[model samples]
Target: MSDQKASTRRIVVGVDGSGPSKAALQWAARQAELAGGVVEAVTAWEYPSFYGWGPAGFDFGDNAGAVLTQAIDEALGPDRRGEVRQVVVCGNPAAALLDASRGAELLVVGSRGHGGFTEALLGSVVQHVVQHAECPVVVIRGPAEATRG
Candidate 1:
């Protein structure tokens, strides 16, 4: 339907099952509601490999899909999930997000994801996407946790 297509603004968001990612998803959903846009929630995963072992014959594709689904379910919840389109791809987070963001009006992502450094303000993936993505990027920062004085 041309009417439906015309009314829908396309928003792409990255989700990695992290707290900030959840916040990003919520923000993206709210933005979509205000703009009458549809959100594309993307999660990127790579094949699991062990250095010591040669091959485990693990089903990484299924696992990747499941992880992406879980992230979407957890982030969007039931009420907002219908407004989002979920995508799981096997690649780097930045590349996947960049690919998904083509022709999108906006791109949203968490400031930090499942990175090792807890003190990091920005994850490498987020930084890469911000620099490379064609669309405008919105980085969602999670609420500050209470710090021990």
Candidate 2:
């Protein structure tokens, strides 16, 4: 009998439809495959200001959750879908991701996101999560070749 025991780890990855986030998801999936771990793909969203007030106000929380779920599903297709658990949280992206990172073996995110130049230092979510999360964090950048493409 082989001495190697099944090693299971919990990996948390944040996704928001950006190229870098997509890269992070792909990297996280490969890591999960290697370690025999489960991947938690989390997406955080909040109500849009336009819908937060007035007579036409709509509760965007559920919609946001649904969008997040879709994004996670797209990231992990049929073959690897079994290893992923999708979570949609209502709050600031950075705070939600950081909160979710507790006790996780690895927390992965993109170097940049949909936030644009306002988040130049490091994408806000990645920066905050890296500063506060208890687990080791991985920030994936677009491939060097892809940058030129």
Best by lDDT: 1
lDDT of 1 at 120: 58
**Per-residue alpha-carbon lDDT of candidate 2 for residues 1-149, written as tens digits (9 for 90 to 100):** 11211244778889776567767888898998888788878887876676546456455666666765666656666566447777778889888887777667899997753344544467566777888888899988855443222
Give the per-residue lDDT digits (tens) of candidate 1, residues 45-87: 8754663354566666667778767877786776763378778
In TM-score terms, candidate 1 sits at: 0.78
Q: Residue 95: error of model 1 in Å?
A: 0.6
Score residue 6 of candidate 2 by CA lDDT: 20
Report the C-alpha displacement of residue 34, candidate 1, in angstroms: 1.0
10 residues in a row with least lDDT, candidate 1: 140-149
TM-score of each: 0.78, 0.75
Runs off by more than 4 Å, candidate 1: 1-8, 49-57, 113-120, 145-149
lDDT of each: 0.78, 0.72
